[model samples]
Target: MKRTTSSKRCNYVLEKLKLHYSGTSYCNCFEPPWLCPEVEECVWKPESNKSKQFTNAVNTWIDLSKKTNNLFIKKQLYEWLDMNHANILAVDRGLYPVERFFPLEKKGIFNTFLGRIIMEILPPCKNTKGKNKILHLLSKACPKRCQIRNLKEIVLQYATEDDQTYLFLLEVMKKSLLGKYNHCKVQLQFEGRHVFYQMFSYQISQKSFFLKWFENGNHQIFLFFCLKEYLCDAVRQVKTVYDYIEKHWKWSIFDKQVVKSMDNCRKILNTISEREYNLLHVSDWISSIESFLLQVSKQHIKLFRTTNAMGYISKLKVNLNKYIISEDLNVDIRQDVSRFLWEITQRTTDKNVFYYALEVLGLEREVVEKVKNEIFCALDYKMLSPNDLFTLKEFCRVIELHKSTYNFVLPKHYYDKQVLSLKKRENKNNQAIGYICFICNDIKFFLTKLSDSSRHSNKLARGSLRVVVDNDISCCHENNLKFVCGKKPERHVKNSKKKWKNDKKALTRKLLKEKQRNFLSKQCIQTPLQEIDLLGHAIQFNNKMIMLCSSCGNVCMLDPESFKYSVNINCKVCHVSPRDICIKCNTETTCNKILVYNQRRTKFHKAPMCNNCTNVYAQKQPVVI
Candidate 1:
């Protein structure tokens, strides 16, 4: 067993080295693994012998090395040097090794939470950059009597106001906040010391300052930065859960594929313990982030606008080597790369319920493609993004003054937006057969699960399922259909009116019908859909019996006008609140989902906050729903 393991390690290292050395003279960021830093210190350490240990391997490595004739590679490993000293020894390879840059206190532990917090936030820190700089400041700048609890205050105390170190430390804090909860912020108060002597002796969170950010606080510094990161992460998780539930609700009502996937997710959520869920969540996030980083590495961009592209290129190469992207079905590499390069100047769902449900239930589709389309919709909706604006401005600038004929002009609709984007025009096109009829394309699958009878034809309790679009030959094909309801709305109808009149007569009629039917309060009024049905009184003569709108998820209704069979389907499903009703005032809020419940069909509420609460809590204090 030991020999076999040793052989595998040797082969792995050899393969990496082969790839590293095989690349061109111009490209050589990929290199050998690091040897033990204390190899010289330990008496038990074997002599630096490379050639004799792997005589056969060194010949191949040297041959590959000579082909490159790269100066960087030459400097690292000279021809005259002993092969043993040049080659890496994989003596202590582990899945994740524990290494620390900062020394332990006399008691053999990280003395304060500050150090540990810093270490935890900035990951893969084989280099002591964070620890070295932090330690250097803390060593002399920190007061012997009392250390400031705040990282910002501590920096200000030790360094001048204009020092760049403050910026660097801030960057570190920002990095630490990555993949953390949005609601993790905490506020700390210490009076009379004037930043110099203030220590994090008294800490308060935005939710409850009395409640410490971490489970434990052994530091004098308040570690408010740390708490803030965790809070952001918490808020993010809560929001994700809410979005998942909302999506599930929609799937249950409309899409058969999504319904089955959501059901599986529900079963998993119900069966699993909290510990398993936490593990799954962590796994999901890690995979998402790593995948993102790997995807970013594949593209070439005007990187960070540094004067010396060489250094940036070298760093980019190193990062690429570290986060290598292999062939994957689950990941749409092109889309991920495009998003990192062109679109994602803002946040989108990293791995939402849609993807997660499919992933856990072993259902396969182009899930990444679905996510990409969603991201595209989000980016286009904000209308001429800064990036888009800049590109347009720069293009025009060049055309006018620079005498460059790139001949790249913005699309006509890009400026006027005369043509509706797919997200906006989701309701009118369904060239496919059942799509025109407002039913699932895979009706056969649903039929297999349920007995074929007239009673169960409209399977859902309230409304029958149907495609969201109809009679647009331009969008009949699958390719056209996929993109159809994905366009951004031309303009937000801020005060969109309800179809019915606001008169006493209308109200009385609505109330009478509401009493006749066992109507739910928050439910969409049946009057509009009923009106749509009433429009086409028995006039369906073999075009296809239609029931729902697949494009905009509208069902059994006259979309734009009442009593008109020719009315083009207008999807209002996009306008419905994402069940984010504020708990305090029952108003729908934006992505505010701190509270969660297991039961289905309960109107999920949102949390509200005032400006004052925001200062006390981070970023609009998310009230518990």
Candidate 2:
């Protein structure tokens, strides 16, 4: 402040410029505080320290490593520095004081991040010696969590058919991830489906690397067979999707894609001859066959051998003795039938919608129930029994035989095939099409062929030549279609005749009602006394003065033909019928009996009582309605 030096003045001017025009002077070309984008960082370069650009980058990385607590950031910094002996020597020779602080094998990065990075930098396919050197470092690495993209890359590019090196490499890769999991133990992706399981899973994916491993792996020569195991898994998946569609006739988009992928994989598999496929699965087949042969040789069957069971065993042996019999065919057929029977058994046990909806056409309810119980009992016994004839696949075969012999009918749903009503037709006429529903009386006029089909009766509108006549009927339903235009059936004609008769009866009733009104009006003026008495009765009698004849102190109408005759006190022959027994006196009486005390109509419930109980009840206090 007393006397400014040149350096202080220059600093003052620079600070003022930075504060006022800082944003204007800045550009994207300026180097970032961390790694420089323009510089090509390499570990092999010895003169990296001598170059100003490289030194600046190294300094920035060192600063970043010191300041950041994040492990991933530190990893990125170390990777930026290109951690290698040559880079280490260059940094040391350059006289960088921070070289000693660099994270090494002892710093926990060795077995984890450093090992993974080293493996990536020196893949076994490219640098086998370097990869081997650091292979020991990966012993502590987490197999399930750690990344191994380089190993997969090695398998894809460098793996050769029957190469010991490739085999050893595959073993190492398999050991890293699939520890203790043998070929049989490795679960298929189809089973145990989970969302997170797909994300981190490095092994057994649809990628080409694993596919190549399967294609190249020699199962016959190696006891640790990789190809045969995963190949079987893929084949099983293909078979499962195919069977559901082929046997059950179920189809879905996802299943279609799965079938396509499996077909592609099968094409790759065909490269290895069918003999190899047999050799791959032969061990399991031989063991099963040996067990069956031993059982037959020892005469294992005793009292359990019924005629049907013996015949089943003979047929099984015949099938097994065929020259073309293979493990895949037998195993697949058995599994398919077992699964189908198991599902059917489960449905029957649960009494699902389909089971409850089952109807027998010509059987009494009792007979149907008994037959159903017997069938279910047999199915339960078959499931529990060890007899060969009752085995799921064998039982299914027996059922098939019986079906051909007896013409056994199955549920309609089981045999029904869903056929599309509106089969899409090509526009050969090159004109717009109109879809019209005569049943619903709906017309989608001048619609393009590409337009979605209109739904009617849960079916799309199909192409058919229909001559529909429009009438006044407003209901958008199929039942009215014949009334509008279509040829009438016998039932429709009968219904029309019945409707005409009903209309005639209704007209006659209307005329009788009008005649009754005119007679009442004329009688009202002619007979004044009757009119006054009737008007008083009509006004006072809210409940039509209807009462049971049994409980009345006076004689009531004996038979009433109509409500008008029953309500008339003068009518002696018309009365409500006495059908109920007396509640108080155990005697026959009318159910609607209401006792009257004095001239006043007492408000009380219709408690059925005999004349003797009514007289006693009249002496006691009357109950209000």
Candidate 3:
């Protein structure tokens, strides 16, 4: 979660890629760095569109140069652009650089349109059309610097068919399909001329990942993600000389020289701060602080060097009590103040202190100036981990110590976006007010409905209130907050508690008494109930005649003409002929069959089978199921 300096991270990439050893990690002819991961991940994504265009532009020039002459370049078309250009960028900015590949000696012919295309647009190359089979171009030069030679004999120093740099350039181009930075600054030796690209690739997971990272990841990109872990541990120390002057020397309030010089120093601090900050005054303010510190050093030369001079240690605290700054000074300006304070404390009596500081800062300015000008040179600003309170304290501490190198000038706001997406409200009361639940997006209280609605979002419920800023759902409360929620304001019920009184109440009681009497009368009559008994009947098989048998009343299967009467009647339930027993017991039923039960069989059981027979059959047959 901590961030380190951009320099340290860049160095890590260099070591990790093995490019610091100076031999190529790419070329298979040499041993390479460790292979990259299969997955793609980088501190900064490489898909800068300007970079892709630069890549494509290089290939276009290569194609143009390769074909400029099956014949000599002087006779080919140059003034007339080939209608078949493969570059997506058709503007003059893209074409001008590639056109520079032509010979400068023929500046006279370039005046004519056709002559320009033939001699100036196309590289002045000679096609030997022999075993050499190579394209050669004349290097363009100023008249004062070069010895004259025939156009065909002039040669580019590095451009050659056999140059190994082209192989590296081609492989890098193929990997450009993934992503690249806006300023890759690639150079390749072409067959006819040198090609310079404004951008290049730095994808760390490609086959040539190490080459790209080592070449441009630090110079072109300054992403901080990679340094977060490192920065977490880089402890910040801010040294100040004022503590040494006051506590260690124990200078009294009556010291005339110290008091008078301190007042002049305070005035100078106020003078520089009265005006706005500009980096141009950086050297001027450093000179002033050095002049003042030199005077103090003259008085305490031995003491100053001997003891690192009463250096006091303090941890970063969030609660700074004195100053609250307005937003105008900005975060970046505050960081510059902290940086200036730290450097001022480092004994700037030697001229090299200011000189070396500016030199180092100038180099940093060159690095990040492309994105946001580091003209202010806000180095080590992150060390103090500034907050509003901390920044204001540092500002005062710098002023108090006569330590501002800026005088009043501040550093550049390199990364401040200052996004202003919202309209500012002029008045608190006039500001368009809304009274709504963020979860429900509703202005009114619907207790039951709110209980039913989903708490996560407002759109899912039917009865949920839709809060609209312009709508006035109800009168404002005593506190002027819109808390009222009445569906129909005119007829809305207010909670009321009172005893009920009406003539209808007496009539309602009388109606209830009559209904109770009818209910009691019905209940008494319904108490006496009846029960019915079921018995088996005899069935004659001869004529399909069915009759109830007087003997035991069991259904019997008999021929009607056997004796012109039913005989040998037996009930399946009772299992007795001309007899009755209790069916529940699996015995004969006597007087009357009570709690008559019907026997139902499984589909596997036979029609005439009893419980005992069915069980015996199931065991013997070995049921399929």
Query: Pick by lDDT: which candidate is best?
Result: 2
- For every model shown, the clashing-pair count is 44, 5, 20
Candidate 2 clashing pairs? 559-573, 559-574, 559-575, 560-574, 560-575
Off-target runs (Cα >4 Å) in candidate 3 are 1-180, 186-460, 464-625
Query: Candidate 2: which stretches are off by over 4 Å?
Result: 1-49, 70-625
Q: Largest TM-score belongs to which candidate?
A: 2
Question: Each candidate: RMSD to true structure?
Answer: 28.7, 37.7, 43.9
TM-score of each: 0.14, 0.18, 0.12
Whole-model Cα lDDT per candidate?
Answer: 0.28, 0.31, 0.27
Model 3: per-residue lDDT, tens digit, 460-539? 22222332222343532333332222222121223211122245675554444434333323322222111111122121
For model 2, residues 313-423, the per-residue Cα lDDT tens digits are 334323432311222122222333333443454344353322223222122344235334533333233232232222322333323332222112323321221011011
> Model 1, 426: alpha-carbon shift in Å?
25
User: Looking at model 2, how many pairs of residues clash?
Assistant: 5
**Candidate 3 worst ten-residue window by lDDT:** 414-423
